[model samples]
Target chain A: MNPLKLVVVTAGLTQPSSTRLLSDRLGEAVTRQLADEGRGVDVHVIELRELAVDIANNFVTGFPSPALNAELEAVTAADALIAVTPIFTASYSGLFKSFFDVVDNTALTGKPVLIAATGGTPRHSLALEHALRPMFAYLRAVVVPTAVYAAAEDWGAADAEGLSGRIARAAGELAELMAGRPATSHATDEVIPFEQQLAALRAQQ
Target chain B: MQFGIFTVGDVTTDPTNGTTPTEYERIKAMVRIALKAEEVGLDVFATGEHHNPPFVPSSPTTMLGYIAARTERLILSTSTTLITTNDPVKIAEDFAMLQHLADGRVDVMMGRGNTGPVYPWFGQDIRQGIPLAIENYALLHELWRKDVVDWKGRFRTPLQGFTSTPRPLDGVPPFVWHGSIRSPEIAEQAAYYGDGFFANNIFWPKEHYMRLIGLYRERYAHYGHGTPEQAIVGLGGQVFMRKNSQDAVREFRPYFDNAPVYGHGPSLEDFTEQTPLTVGSPQQVIDKTLTFREYFGDYQRQLFLMDHAGLPLKTVLEQLDILGEEVVPVLRKEFAKNRPAEVPDAPTHESLLANKPDEVPVEAR
Candidate 1:
């Protein structure tokens, strides 16, 4: 069986962004949980701030930049994704939001997703469920039940013990999802042609 | 760990020789730095979008689409997707198109933007930035969620019946994080929606962000999304690291003092003291960053500003090497040893979509 592939995506533009830190912690937690579950996993994290300029320029010229293409490939291949961003004005940041606008719509089809956010205050924590989750739902991605939101206060109290527990739980959820039973349908099921059905019937006859 | 590098898009004078890279050179160099970030095992690469003269990231999707084709695992993101000035309908359409192009490794941050004058250029009023942000985002949200939406709001004209095509992958819309520096209202907005709140802790002191985050956590719980501790959070930071602490400071002080955004405003020492900017050795950066949890709590994501200040491409590449090889490993271990199990880690694609109680089929329900 292939090891579960997890991709953590973040959009934190500042030098020391809370969004990046949250993304990292989530990734580490998932890695450790997978290890504990006796399952090997490949974890990948992609920060969006680095790709902002290229993505932005590509939008203007009607040409996809080389960098954008490569990042797109990553999303298409990932088994699961952890998406983190900073809340701005009750929504995701423009930079963080715009980056998603460039991805191929089919990449997230049926892929499992975990939505998370970082902000100055905890009030915006719901942004993950109300804002981010709904967005993923529209894309047809399966969002995990629990989403984590870290406020500045949480960071202040983030002792080693406190932080690790959070990671374990989040990772545990991810592990369960990865180990959960696979859907019993194949891509061809929805597209069975009349002739193909007839042929199958004749063969059965 | 979530490792990646971000650029601030500054056309700076080469301090050593007093020669500055042009804006175009600086922009292209930022792209090279992004690719290099991926090569060195970083997870995500994001850039800022500024329509001003000193910056050149006006079209984020265009550049990210290019990068998406080249790298294999690197997720692409944006620093700011202008919600105040840009039309929500266009935003909905554009991002949907990109979603199809980049697969699903896409998410974004939305903001009113820092520049005050940009409002006029886009036929908007600066005074109404807050209203514009709220209304625009509401529309953008509907555009992504509803297959066919008829929306009328204060900011944009009513839509008779519009559908944003290239429907989100498997019906999952891109994730979002709301970023703010000084706006509590934005934080409230994020909480109201149960979205992510991002505090770009680069310019302000920890206390300021702390207050905002505190309010968000409380409200998040109030809204019944989860306990405040369960809310997702992320932050921003800037660093100039080298093997030697002294050398790191020596090399970065001039750039810190002369760069456009924060140049000549505060002494480097004062800036670092008050803000998230750390211009020193990797250890110093790590030390300062770890302290963040002391003020905030066990957060999820952390990103660094490495390729700014007109630093040469060569220097930026070197920075990524240090980050991937040295700083990240220690931080990962330290952070892991610290997080709490009940607290919940940040959300991921798998975790978010797990155990989704069987959807009530439209017909059966």
Candidate 2:
């Protein structure tokens, strides 16, 4: 069996960013969870910090740079996604939203996404439910129920559903969602035979 | 392969001088450019059609009609005639009329026009763009072929036993090419009819066009339109040349920085590297252009966007002279060398008329 391809999208602005740390943790946890069930995995991490200029340029130019396009291609074709972002004010960082904005919204439909965030305070933890979950829902991605939030203190603290525990739980849910599905092959230019397109139009009218 | 220039007919201000040509001057300039195209030994001269401001060519056939009278050798065509907004019957009538006047020196490319308001202004919903293109072009295709036609579609009033007059010169309709920036359905539509598929290779990455052209070729063969290599293809390019490569870049940078549609987005150097836009000496332009056939597999037409971005008429004329004398002669020779005979040249009135089957007119039937 081919290894399940997992893509980790981290919108970490700094080199020592906890957002990326959370993303790596989530990626590792999911691989372990899937491994326990004898499933092999191939993990690919995409750091959005390097893509900031490309993302902005894509908005202005209405086309991705070749480098950005390659990363987008990977994200769209992966079997599962682990998206981690640092919280800014009341929502995910603008860079995080911008990265997903460039992705074709429908490309994530039925994709298994494990949404996680890191911020200075645990007060913003519910942001996962309000912001990330709803956004993925709108994109039609099947976001896992156990969204992990690793606030500044939670990283060093041990509470119920601690950072590590939440990561494992979220990873487990993502693994289950991914385990039931095959590796996705998002053929970019999937041609609908002209006849069928005409037929579909005829049906519409 | 046919080589020519395609212009959006944009009335833009020169970024360096902040001077915009009046609409009158722009229109005359297009005619001058067409005549220069003929003098320079270019094979085709295509113009874009846009109804909105800053774009002058609203009625393509009107301009092509005038150009046909002035030029002898140029194959007058359109970057795209709006297939969605314009009535297909009118398109059929107009181009056929132009065909007669031009003595068959005409072909047309079909495109769904840009901008949302152009749709409502023409009584169309932007959401139905694909269907409108399909239905309208289907009618235009039928009108040019059959003497009379009965047609019913969702968008327009049905026609019964109606004839589009001045029937395609010598019983062969103008060859149609579907131009698309990013639509697979358009590519498939072109392949289904064995019509030409033109990729607007100027604004986007080459990879995008490679995929599009690849799909078009695969589907062209699938639809029994000969082998993929035999499917007719056209590509768009943008080039600015000077004696010195640095001079070309330096002179074109202001226009590149502020040009409409894609200006101020990517740097000139990045745009030149990523897309087909080349700003350099004649040799650099030729070297970059020769790689296009390598990427697209010996296409039938290569049209450059040369006259836009407020390029002064004199400068544009000079660029044409360089193209005709220095660049294109070399390109023509290089493109023709080791070229497969199966790959057709850009279809023209004569080739199409000659290839027309011997058949009785529908009126006689």
Candidate 2's displacement at residue A7, Å, is 1.8
Compared with the true structure, what per-residue lDDT tens digits does model 1 show for residues B1-365? 35565555656676767877876787778778878878877877877878887677888888888887787777677777888998887777777676667776777778889789998999999998877787788778888878898866665667888887777665666767788887877777777777878788876667778988887777677777788887767788888898898898888888887666666555677567657788788889889888978888777777788876667778888989988888888888898785777666545444444633566689996
lDDT for residue B112 in candidate 1, whole number 0-100: 86
CA deviation > 4 Å runs, candidate 1: A1-205, B353-365
Least accurate 10 contiguous residues by lDDT in model 2 chain A = A182-191
**How good is the docking of model 2, by CAPRI class?**
medium
- Candidate 2 stretches greater than 4 Å from native: A196-205, B361-365
Per-residue error (Å), model 1, residue B182: 0.2
Docking class of 1: incorrect
User: Considering just chain B, what TM-score does every model have?
Assistant: 0.94, 0.98
On a 0 to 1 DockQ scale, where is model 1?
0.01
Per-residue alpha-carbon lDDT of candidate 1 for residues A1-205, written as tens digits (9 for 90 to 100): 5677788889988877888888888888777777787877788778788887766754543334556667777777777889999999998888877777777666788888878888888899888888898888888888888788888888777575554556566667877787663532323213222234334433532
